[model samples]
Target chain A: MATEGEGSGFAIHPMDQFVIKPLFGGEHVHWYTISNVTLWMALAVLCIVLLLVVGTAKRSIIPSRVQSVAELVYGFIYNMVEEVTGHDGVKYFPYVMTLFLFILFSNLLGLLPMSFATTSHVAVTVVLALMVFVGVTVLGFMRKGVGFLGMFWVSSAPLALRPILALIEVISYFVRPVSHSIRLAGNILAGHAVIKVIAGFATLVVASPFVVGAVGAIYGLELLVAVVQAYVFTILTCVYLRDAVGDAHH
Target chain B: MATGTETAAEAAGHGGGHAVGMPQLDFSTWPHQIFWLLVTLVVIYLVLTRLALPRIGGVLAERSGIITKDIAIADDLKQKALKAERAYNDALAQARADAARIVAEARAAIQADLDAATARADAQIMAKAAESEGRISEIRAGALDAVTEVAQDTAHEIVAALGGKADAGSITAAVAARLKE
Candidate 1:
């Protein structure tokens, strides 16, 4: 399968890092199968529990390190929801917090050596994005009823251009989940793949030093990406929520 | 290096002897990934909604509430201190005024006593001076009478030595006139 150029003991399979393998060692990944995806995701859940539950068990006025971390994450997402969705949107704080913690831990945990990045997969991110999309759509309809469709309709535009503007608005609205999921998956997938490709070059004895240095630098960047991607996803969720809960800007 | 190559070969075998384009695009694993993702999301949602968020929110609210209560108590204490200081100042001013009044009253009382003593002393001195003056006049009167009697006796003896015999009544009359002059 090697193009003759890479046959000289210099091979790079960047995508292999994303492949799902059963945790208990099986070739087939059945729907109910316990795979690496479950392990990392479960680890993320454990981390969330430890930070949120056990860390704050004392319920101290002055928080411990872990408790403060939990509180900081809580406050950060809480404030984001409050600011973006306004006062009325604070009801959705837990949902947004859940999304942020899951993505954040998944991305960070995936950076470990030989660990599968669950967020790097489109299948995982699409479900997350769709949840937000569907939840927001239902909430918008529930709260504002038919007036929710008014979001796509640009009322301020000229009557003749209103339909065109709305068409664009509707397209963009539907495209939100696609773009949202792709953005996160693409970023993680790209960063991991780039690092893998660079590491593959370490086989050439001369490039080994540069490769190591580059990998370190890219790893640092990926850490920042992991956090930023989480923030972006959470903030976008809040922005969508604003449409449902907040007063109409149009 | 051997393990790396072995894993690479094994991955290739899994990929049908070629690297898969993108494991993300593999539809066969989508359902598996989706199911777990849903499970993970549900668990997280439940954990957060049930436990974490409410606790954190309660802690924050409680902290702010404590801070606000502390501030209010501090403010109340400050006001009380100010009131106490004002009361202290008022009492000090009142005591100062009372002390001044007492001193003035004491001074007035002492002055009245001194004035009364001085007036009494003057009345006594005046009475003693009047009595002394009355005694001096009486003594002057007595000395005048003695001088008059002596002059009469001398006049009578002189007339007798001159061998001039006079009547007793005349002699007495002449002595009386001379004494009068």
Candidate 2:
């Protein structure tokens, strides 16, 4: 009376890492680690490099299909930069375009079975976030110098509370990178982990086709989540870049 | 401070949870960052500044050349039309001059013919006048003789009717009367 292939099912924690390390770590440090997350990151970079190289190799009056696609991506990023940062934003087009392409490729790569979502890892996300934070902070100082510090305070508040407000502003500024990294990692980790849990249930429950169908539907929904998360990350990066260059109220 | 080997051993046993504890600001990552950033920046700059912009500029230049060439052709056509009009006007003027010359020549020829006809008429009149002069004198003499005869006849008839004297003085009077008539 029992259905086949029914068991409690093997559970996998979303934080699991498959590490690959070398023998020595001295002057000529021969060390390499291949984790699920790192694998997807490397793949994303490769994809982006290939796209850039192949798309622009042949410069023609009348563009080929690949060239047009590259142009479209360029135009899209250009407009996005212009809209957020106004006229001065065009100078940052290259950075914004790279960010979009990298995150988009990484997200898509993670969608593959057994592939790690690098963005889901706090370390990787933190690195990217910190890079933005440091870059923006340096830019602000370079552009405005000592005056840039005033960006945190001197809002429409009363002059009496300016000191307290400035302290609060400093704290908020420090939290920026942490929040940015956590937002990306949390969304990706939750989605992938939910899918994994549902899939595991589907494997364990052989008697109910309904349960399997439900899990399949959730998996399909996860695909949409993956793309949405990538878009959100890119857009947020753009917003941050705009704030970095423009008025601090952003 | 755990050695590299200890960290790996710990990572293996704990499933790589060591990455979550505290982030070590690895100086090694800086080289990678700088290298990648420079590579990206240079490649993008070369593509946009060198390749794409130049191609777009060439297309614009070629279009300008075509438009200027078209204008030149139009100007040339206009000049040719003006030249043709001038030639047509010159040919018409020549034809008008030729017509005026032919008309003047025809008028002169007609005038010469009229002068010759007038001269011929004057010569005929002179010749006729000379020939008619002698005939006219002979006619006058004959007429005078006929008048004397008629008078003598008439006087004789009258004297015979009257039966008075028939003298020389009466006869002379009768001759004078007949001449008067």
Candidate 3:
């Protein structure tokens, strides 16, 4: 696999596409400089605007195709937040919908022939998971004061084990953001990498058709993962918010 | 398992210039990724909060309102139609009863007229019979008078012709006694 710049070798470079090179020629990536990541994220935003805002501009009772799509998205995110978080959690529906839509659009768009999968990066997903983590923590403290610390305490456990159980619970509680972000990034990254690896073998004429067919199968699975990951993230956020706002259960 | 392969492939290549590791672990690109992600997500959040969600909510509320109004109108119309139907049936029954009463009244009036006509006809028939009986009785009386007068005159004529004395009072008495015997 270490065949760098070896002219006659048929080596595959899957990570080359993920390099954060500037869109302009010969310029290194800067904080403000536009890059492929900036372009794609903007595109995701554009898509969200088109689907959610522009699509429903007409507000027709008998919805057109775009309107139907907009309504379905609206109802889906709305119902999910309402059901998972309950009435108190419903106030944060827009934030949850925004998170769900952004991730969903990014995952779907990342599947393009040549595009960046932003959600596949830890930098992006960790920020999102941190936002949820920090927001829920702050809300819990604000609403319940010192009682919020009771979240880590296992009250029903035997007194001898409660101290040890609380330590584990606190550690696990802090690890939520790490696992949450990693789960999404890992799923997206692996699916795309497998497809690219399989597609690189397409240059060989003997196994090209079979490999390409397998790529297609993987593509179908990736599509499923794309939507499912978004749903998982949003539902987890709701569950955490419910825990933060709801009565203590454990 | 899959990340190992991806990282291994990345690590094996490009030893001199910017060695690629696990992309998720690559610290160089984190700032770029995080900056753009924050910008994009914040804009998206604002769009949903200020524009999209509200617009969709309005459409839903408007549709529900229109449906409720239409249902209310339909219910009102149904009640009105039911009331009209009830009134029409009642009027129809009243008209039938009225028609029956009119037929009975007409029949009774006709019976009374027929009875009056029959009574008038019976009175006329009784008067005509009584008048005929009176005329017959008068004619019998006249015939009886004529027979008595003729018998007396004949007896007087016969007595004179036979050369015997004719007495008017004695002839009358003898005729009457012979007629009685």
Candidate 4:
């Protein structure tokens, strides 16, 4: 791709930014290798710590700036879990909060110059989505026994159409993880890649101003996307969890 | 030209690991990315579950609890204030009623005293008038007797001057009859 772009009178290797490279300078990437992924992930962890742990060290009834942010995020995710999954699903709050904060911080950090976006990769998002998927499935079985399969049965459907609806329900149920993971990975990947491609045009002196303005606009949009994607991912997890722990009224 | 050659050389060297298509599909780096991602997720999970979530949750709960308690206290204070105002109003009414009663009692006492004084003055005036009436009647009776005697003496002198004998018994009887008339 770089060579092709070189032939086209411009050098733009947009995918280069997503390349995995060791931090200490080496050609090899091992499972134990410390890479840019580690650094950015560590930064996210630090941000979480600063906002959640140290910011609230005083336990003040009136919160400081960082403490209030921490409290807002907590209440936001906690209420989401409680409302979507109902009261019983409140136990999974920590898991949902973990994913939300990690994705939210990663997406925002990736917007910085020369920063790597961890959530843009399929591997990371796949693990996250699968965790929610497997957990909800297992919890459904545990809580409802064989009754969990009844979700796909669609008892409200007419008897003649019940089988077809059940088949559709089952297929959609299995597709959740794929759609869940791809939705997040695709959004981040596309946004970052678009920005890179637009920035590549800035190499020309004439287009630099417009490129800068466009990139700025996209950056603002990406910021909204970052928070929104995180919210969507968490709320979807809560919705899936509701199938497991929610009442049988549906 | 030299830098371009070096960059090409570097790219050639990394050809073993470089992604020809999307870096996201680079099969060789999957293990490395997956491992780091797992570590990150685990660390985040532990940090949140063990530290962050509980603290934030506690702070939120405590804040709401404090707010509810404060509201309760404010309500209690309002009730107390209302009670105090009612007590103050009741005391004011009681004082006003007492003042009116005291004024009425004082007015009644003053009216009784004034009536007694008027009665005593009237009795004294009546007694003085009666005693003056007795003295006046006594003086009138004495004057009548003196007038009769004077009349008798004058009559006797008139007869003597006319060269007629004057009898004391007839003159006395005539004076007496004249006085009676």
lDDT of 3 by residue, A135-160 (tens): 99999999899899998889999989
lDDT of 1: 0.88
lDDT values, one for every candidate = 0.88, 0.62, 0.84, 0.86
Q: How badly does each model clash, as a count of residue pairs?
A: 0, 0, 0, 0
TM-score of chain B of 4: 0.53
**Residue B87 of model 2: what lDDT?**
92
Clashing pairs in model 3, backbone N/Cα/C closer than 3 A:
none
C-alpha lDDT of residue A236 in model 1: 98
TM-score of 2: 0.55
B12-33: candidate 2 lDDT, tens digit per residue:
3343333322122222322333
Among residues 3 or more apart in sequence or in different chains, the pairs in candidate 4 whose N, CA or C atoms overlap within 3 Å are none
If the candidates were sorted by their lDDT against the true structure, best first, what order would they fall in?
A: 1, 4, 3, 2
Task: Go through the candidates in order and give the C-alpha RMSD of each one to the true structure.
Answer: 7.9, 14.1, 8.1, 6.9
Worst lDDT 10-window in candidate 3 chain A: A1-10
Best lDDT among the predictions, by candidate number: 1
What digit string (tens of lDDT, one per residue) describes model 1 on residues B69-126?
Answer: 9999999999999999999999999999999999999999999999999999999999
Runs of candidate 1 exceeding 4 Å displacement: A1-7, B1-19, B100-181
Q: What share of the true interface contacts does candidate 1 keep?
A: 0.66
